[model samples]
Target chain A: MVINVKNLVKRYGDLIALDHFNLEVQEGEILGLLGPNGSGKTTAINCILSLLKYDKGTIEIFDQPMSPDAYDIKRDVGIVMQNVAVFEELTVYENIDYFCGLYIADRQTRKKRVAEAIDFVGLNDFIKFFPKKLSGGLLRRLNIACGIAHQPKLIILDEPTVAVDPQSRNNILEGIQKLNRQGATIIYTSHYMEEVEQIASRIAIMDKGKIIAMGTNEELKKKIKSGEHINLELLNPEDLDLEAIKALPHIISAELTDHQLVVKSGRDKNNLIAILDHLKDQNIAIGKIYSEPPTLNDVFLEITGKELRD
Target chain B: MQVYKAFFRIIQKNRSQIAIYLVVFMVLALLLTNAYTPPQDTDFTKTRFNIAFINEDGDSELVDGLKTYLGENANLVDLPDDPQQLQDALFFRQVVYILRVPKGFTAAMLNGQEVQLEKTIVPDSPSNIYMDLLINKYLNSAQTYFAYLPGLSQDQLVDYLKVDLAEETAVTVISGSSHSANAEKSGYYFNYISYSLFAILILGVCSVMLVFNDTDLKRRNLCSPIRSATMNFQMILGNLSFAVLTWLVLISASFVMYGSYMFTTNGLLLLLNSFIFTLAALSISYLIGNLVKSRGAMSAVANVFALGTSFLSGVFVPQELLGANVLTIASFTPTYWYVKANNEIANAVSFNAGNLQSIFTSMVLVLAFGVAVLGVTLVLIKQRRVEA
Candidate 1:
């Protein structure tokens, strides 16, 4: 295991931020910690990094206990905080070099790594620009560059794409994959489920400071009764019977709104064809039709009875 | 070392602000130094008065002797025996005293008869009292000679009075040092340094520290591989270097302005006092840095603390001139002791144990203040870390 956290409990006065949180990240894999805001994702990360004191927990990294003074363990870990943490007085190149120097004492090696980090973030043209002069997206990129410039064995990014523009967000997501390919174990945390689903090899769904479910995309989908959703635009939706559509084979629920009809079904093949034949026999002309596989939202809604974004 | 380097980089970025303070202080020091003119010789000199002597008793041996004696101490302005002219002269301050000798005044004196000489003088003139003493001395001596030594002639009496009145007493001033003009100028310059040093250090050191103590930045630094002890050591080293560099610049400026005077014992004492004050200012800056949460608050604290202490103490106003209540309140601040020490250093004529005792005591007090403030800052830092 690259990171092992067992029975972590953190509290702030009467409020419990983390209640018996347990996580184990394997080597050379991206572990996406998915949750809404205030779901203890950051608190858990802080506890694991030893940046915070937990009420009760055991955090071991690389088989060694983690602590505030665990310099050896800390040397192999890189962290990019949720907020931009670069010094406003320093330029892009200086900020990267300063952070890199913290890990790499050798001047030559640090210089090369800083240059690579800048290039990786596509900030070579703005190397001399101060953080205040950069746009929000560029500043976030600079923040990421500062963290990863040291090239540690394990990297933890906390909401690195929050408030980022789409283009910059894409650049950052692609960069994380590249870093993982370079043999760095990564732990990514965010509330955006699509992001986690897109890049995370294994996903851990968190709510109220505990992981509600943990599995791969396929395995997690199998845990819920919801399988797929077929949406149809009908010319005469008022003429269709929702009861007849719901009574079809493999169909779990059906609803009609305006000129559209939505049918949700269980895990069964040909559920889309069954819904199409039923709509045709009812003489409800279809204008458009599409099918969507069960997403993390369906799994979240089935397990927690709440939207993934709520 | 990264922390240390970054400290100076932040300071370098703020060099323009620091330079403005330096220039303003230099101008203020020069202006204060030039505005004052210290006394050259603190010795006493006799006052001479303008007087008109109307000798109506005419060219007698006694009258000639009196004229000769009056001429030695007073300027005898020639004027007619007109009352209006004499009155006008006295009123306009052209002459302060007018003496009119009545006829046969010498004969009356020889016959041992008391006769008064008529006099006109300015009212409430301080110099007139001295003229009165001189005339009384001459007349009293002449009368005594005529009465006691009846065998002596008028000429002999006049000669004897002149000889006796000519005798004088010697006076001397005692001081351990010359109290030169340069000493006064340098004292003013160093005293003014209290305000500038406090302001600059607060602005510079606190600004840098605020950036480093930022919540996000501090968390990021704590996650790094660098040991906390190492980071603290580098930060302290950076603060010390900046403080010492500022002290060196101000001291060098004093040397340039005061020349060899800065090498004197009193000047060296001033330098030591200022150095101690610099340490105190640094401690204060550290405290403010920890207490303040933003740059705006930092600026406000710097101005209030620096300007406030300076006014209460003797930076802008001399301690001697400040009210007793103000000094009592100012005694709690290190700048008070610093200015007190500077004042003692300026006026010290000797470098003996007795003379230097007060200066060293004041310096120790200032140093104690710095240590106390540093202790408080350390406690605050510890509390913050534990809370974090």
Candidate 2:
């Protein structure tokens, strides 16, 4: 395992920031930590990195105990924080060089790594620009480049794309995939479900300082009763046999409202064909048909009964 | 090492603070030294008193001699015999003094009777009183010479009195190093030095600190492999580098301006004194940096500390003129000790052990202030780190 945390607990006065948080990251996998705004995802990451004092638990990186003085471990762990942390006075090139120099001492090797980082983030044209001169998206890219320049084995990014434009966000996600392909374990945290779902190989859902659920996208979907939803619009719904449609195979629930029939099926059930067959037998005139698989929000809603955003 | 280099780089990028300090220091030093007049300066040749000479008596050798003497000493101005014009000239500062030679003045002096020379002048004017004394001295000296020396006639007496007496009795005097007016004046320039040094140290260190204490940047650094102690040491190294640079700029400027007098023991003492004060100012800067939360707040603290200390410690005014209670309060500040040490060094006749002991004690006290403030800062930083 590239990263392992067990029974971690942290507190701030009367607040419990992290409670019995346990996590494990395998090599060459993107582990996305998904949560709401105050779900202790960042607290868990900080505790794992040994940046904060944990009241209880053990955190190990590369199977060794983590500490603030763990140079050997820290040397191979890179962090891109939620906020832009580069010096405003330093140029893009200088900022990358400064951060990289902390891990690599060889002058020639550091220079090469800095160049590669700038290229990796597509910031070659902006190497000489100060942070204040760059757009917000460009500055976020620079922040990422500074952290990953040394090519560490394990990288932790906390809300890296919180306020970025769509294009830049895509670029950042692609960059994370490239880093993972280069044999690096990544821990990504974000409240944006789609970004996490698109990039994370395994997902861990946290709430109120605990890992409420942990699985792959398919496994997490299985934890809830929700499945693919099918919608059909009927031209003359007044004569439709709604009772028969409700008794279809693998149908968990069915309802009709405003000349439309909506059907929800169980997990891994292909009820769309079955519903259409039933509609054809009844000689029902369909105006429109649509299908949507259950999203992370559905799993969260079924599991917590509250909007993930709320 | 990288941390130290980065810290220094930040300081180097802030050139505006250094430039302003240097410019203000140099200008104030030059202007103060040029505008200052030493108390011992006495070149009376430039002084010319105004007088209206009235020779109502017929021309005699005595009267002519007196007229020549008065003309050499005073600028004789013609009056229109109007009282109001005289009053206006004196009131408007056109004339600082006035005198008149009465009639029969030569005859009264020949008989050696008590005869007085009438003078018109303003009341309660000190310069006019001084002029009256001068006129009496001149007449008395001539009368004494006329009584003692045998002369062919009164005309010959006037000629005999024309001999220059002060030239024959002139004496030469030399001053010791303790009394060197230049040394004293150079020491006075340090009053401004305290203000400039305090200002620069506060602003420079505060700017450096703002970058280091940035929330995100600080978190990033803490997460790095470097130990907190190493980072703090490097920060101290950077601050010392900046303080030394400030000291060198001000000291070099002072030396260039007063090199002839400063190449001595007293000069070295003054230099040492300033260096110690710089350290104290830097410690104060560190304390202020930790207490403040924003750049604007840092600026306000810097101004209050620098200007406020200057006013309380006699940098803005002479220590002798300040009230006793104010001096009692000022003794608690490092600037007061620094100025005290400087005065002692400037007033030393010789580099005796006792004088050296006093100077060293003052410097040590200033250094103690820095150490004490730095200790508090370290404690506060430790507490904050523990809480974090």
Q: Kindly report the fnat of each predicted structure, to 2 decimals.
A: 0.67, 0.53
Clashing pairs in 1: none
What TM-score would you report for chain A in candidate 1? 0.97
- Please identify model 2 stretches exceeding 4 Å from their true place: A232-249, A254-262, A277-287, B41-170, B173-179
- The lDDT values for all models are 0.88, 0.84
How many residue pairs clash in each candidate at the backbone level?
Answer: 0, 0
CA lDDT, candidate 2, residue B233: 87
Worst 10 residues of 2 chain B by lDDT: B164-173
lDDT of each residue in B1-388, candidate 1, tens digit only: 8999999999999999988987887788778767977766657566788999998887689888988899999888999888898889888999999988999898888888889998888889886788888889889888788778999987788878888989987766543233467777788889888888988899999889899999899889888989866887898788889998888887888888888888889888999999999999999898888788888998899899999999999888889999999999999999999988888888766778876898899999999999999889877775554234
- Interface RMSD values for the candidates, listed in order? 1.5, 1.8
Q: In candidate 1, how many Å is residue B294 off? A: 1.6
In candidate 1 the C-alpha lDDT for residue B65 amounts to 92
Cα displacement (angstroms), candidate 1, residue A293, comes to: 1.6
lDDT of 2 by residue, B92-157 (tens): 766666555567877777777777766677668776766776677668778788778735476676
Measured with C-alpha atoms, the lDDT of residue A129 in candidate 2 is 93
Q: For all the predictions, what are the DockQ values?
A: 0.50, 0.37
Instruction: Please give me the DockQ of candidate 1 compared with the native complex.
Output: 0.50
